[model samples]
Target chain A: MKFLVFLEHHGDALEKGGLGALGKAAALGEAVGVVLGEGASALAPGAGAFGASKVFASEDPALAPPLPQPRVDALAALVVQESPDAVLFGASVLSADVAAGLAARLEAGLNWDLTDLEVRDGELVGKRPALGDTVMVDVGWTDAPRLALVRSGALDPVESGGGAEVESFEFETSDFSTLATLVEQTQEESTGPSIEDADVIVAGGRGLGAPDKFTLLEELANALGGAVAATRAVVDAGWYPYATQVGQTGKTVSPKLYIAAGISGAIQHKVGMQGSGTIVAINKDPNAPIFDFCDLGVVGDLHEIVPKLTELVRAQRGS
Target chain B: MKIAVCVKQVPDATVHKKIDPATKRLDRFGEAALNPTDLNAVEEALRIKEAAGGEVVLVSLGPEKAVESLRKALAMGADRAVLVADEGAAGSDLLGTSRALAGALERVEADLVLFGQASSDGDGAVLWAAVADRLRRPLISQAASLEVGDGTITGKRQTEHGYDVISAPLPAVVAVSDAINEPRYPSLKGIMGAKTKPQETISLGDVGVDAGAAGEAGAKTTVLELGPPPSRGDSVKIEDDGSAAQKILDYVVERRLL
Candidate 1:
């Protein structure tokens, strides 16, 4: 019944999805947090607060940002030493690579991209949209170590009771191969707030003429205490970083409240964000594709609506 | 450079899928094919071979049916193909899968190993990196654009922030992305040529690997349960009337969506 969690981090602090994954680890017997790379201890208290019984870290300095395959190898080695019944990973790209790699190292099947999950018959049955959302796939590994990749925002991460015991296990050493060396890393500080943890997300699309016009989107995002997202076009134009792009080629986000402005919803975009708890779209084009998928569709100019809404929100918040 | 591309068969991404009541998962009933990404890797390997004059060996460890993908690789111009078929290898998890593939690769002398970012079904995208680890080689992943000249290689690696140029020495492992190149269709002559080509198959013992370490015991992740997809919601039918635009706008206001 043991559940092991892979805790993702942003420079020593736990990531939102990692918190979500930590919450998921609660159901699996004794929870262990497997962290990769340097400065995994800053996450120790956060991991304990989130619900890990023990945190295991690989403090390898050669590990690069984003590509966590080396960490996967370390986790696999850990699984060999401590055979947990289940492993859970956040559905972010870096975590997914680590999860899949660790799962391969363990010869386990993965229930991936799950928006919903439940334990039935002593098994974790995971569900995800498949085939353009045309069909649902329930993925579970019967004979292998139970592995689940839960999407961010799919589960609410609350205080997991005890700021539990933080036991640090020495990384069972192995001669690491193909050390994923980071030749370069470009990090753009997000404007408003971190979107993965944002309860509300304000998204823009090609309708916003220039990258600076994204300031208005940021204004709306600031008013809502949310993060600003952009479509594939915005990211392609290099107006926004790829992390802020919510679409097929970009990050798949499932925020609770999503407000899309001046955006056209392509199926690829819809696939990424349709899981939002609530969706509202604003665009001047009556037939803009976003209207089809959003819970609330506004056929108007975002330039007009966004500014007015920002004012309303600011007034409501007494900011 | 001796390059090996590990490919897997996947259900075409665009195929219509149905949920299997028995499995409670997306029922890809009968229409699984080689992962579209593998073809991209195959094409990339062909391009690399065309430029560098190295042999491209396509290797996959799956059931006997996996040869279909190997044939496609050969059709795509891979110089050779290998299928490692064993029942114990069946239902191999990511680690065991990578281990088995790595074992097979040990038998072949190669300078580079290539793989797609990931297979569509597992989408875990772990094999190439894991195999690279198992092979004890330098690894680079998510390369969207690649150029090989002399003893040096350069590729643009995709990241959530943006792409960064990666340089690696020879005898490196790389996983290519679908954006790298379009896989070409196998001409009739290529198809005919693949039939006459040779493919080597090896065993778990011969490759010098542990059997228990592979298959289920090697896996660390597991699927907990299967659930059907969320029910499709009521469609917001846009009325064809030209003036319905105003109604949509009003609906937008009522929801406080502005």
Candidate 2:
């Protein structure tokens, strides 16, 4: 089976999720990378290391911004041109829009929030977690040119020590596609590695008592050379930025160490971090659902214990 | 400035959802509530209607029972509601659902279309985009804040790295995030008046969608199997007697995490 993987990039680096999807697609069958935007061709050649045997690039100026419609138009044209068996994306704010729009444009089927994909009996099957991540369901498409959006961080990009042949394609954007304009874009001011890339994550939930209490998690994260994350409740409450949210509607992380402070361990949050190497929970409620799954559960007031733990970690790390 | 808000009735978030063993689909017989974020969209539309001289019409696609959810939204001050209910539309995936919704929106002919970022049940978060594409309109998603001006609307939305401010013309689609605004509770008077409000339920054929092109028949994806998630293994619990920090540190050290 032939697969086309959408590779989203910022400046020069390709998004990890897209690269991971490309890697998996290459492992399964012939994988081609699709790159768009001003510098898309520059990023196309690098797709080889991540397992794409060939890269198709469209450097249309209209596709430079992170808008979805233009990319959808370009991708739709490519689908009609190449007719790949499937189109895959590593889920993101932008890629989700593009994938869904492409699906609508092509009148094709899309399976989203997928955690895994494999070929069984000559058919591509997707594994999706549903019902609050308590159940896993196997999903498949009934027709060709299947579209799928894999969950963020669900796959890791692998280096195959190969090179890809780069090809350029041309496409037209519909008038409606150009109707929306990006006025401005600004990054959140943050220090340390991002949650997705952090080795350790110190996550705070409503149990932190107040928004100001998040400083405790931040300090702990800083001491451990990690990053701080928050539950959807806190983020929705404006206690933290949406970018740091870790849950069903947010980015998924698989850090080496995940410390849940004052979190009740809702399934929404559990699915995002369940892949961590070591899971620890600090909560006052002994009956908190987090205790049922965490590798180590500490029943205590996080306000009291988090500070002490931060000090010990600071002393041990000697930072 | 006529605005149409798309809403959904999702299984209650507090309830432990289960998939039916026979159908491999979520059992919807349990308690249900209007999707939380869709309320945000409704609230935004109401605010826009209050400021501008226009009507707020609700558009939904679900079983007939979903009228309950529409009534709740109507009590929040929407003018009227239209629900495309048909057995042929059941078990519809994102694409199939978007087809029917796009058709309904076209029939509504509102200047502005609104939707929540995603439904808590499927959590696909991309239906608005699909609908927008099907309707051939501009789309903006994850809007944290919105400003309507002459023939145009600007939205501020959060992204993984930062935030973006996007602008699109009228006759476009926008999906608001939970951060957009707090939804208002139905007033006593509004609740009483909601019963008299106009609610029309139609079928897929009414929206010009063929029976074969909707629901399970039009769905391009199929569920092959269902089972429980993998276990996380055993856990060790300890009560804090002023020594919890020390124990946690020891566990971290054993794993060399620090």
- List the DockQ of the predictions in order: 0.29, 0.75
lDDT of 1 at B79: 87
lDDT tens digits by residue: candidate 2, B153-194:
999977888899999999999998878898999999999999
lDDT of 1 by residue, B9-28 (tens): 66656675554555343454
TM-score of 2: 0.95
Query: Quality of candidate 2's docking, in CAPRI categories?
Result: medium
Candidate 1, after superposition: displacement of residue B197 in Å?
A: 6.9
TM-score per model (chain B): 0.87, 0.95
The TM-score obtained by chain A of candidate 2 when compared with the true chain A: 0.91
Question: What is model 2's DockQ versus the real complex?
Answer: 0.75
lDDT of 1 by residue, A1-319 (tens): 6777888776657777776777766754567887766677556666777778787766665444556656766777777778887788876656766775665555566666776666667776677766545556555665546777887667667576676555555444345443445667656665555677788898999888788989998887887778988887787677877678776656678887788887888876887788886787877788888887777676776776677777666765683
The residue pairs found clashing in candidate 2 are: none
Quote the lDDT for B148 in model 2: 97
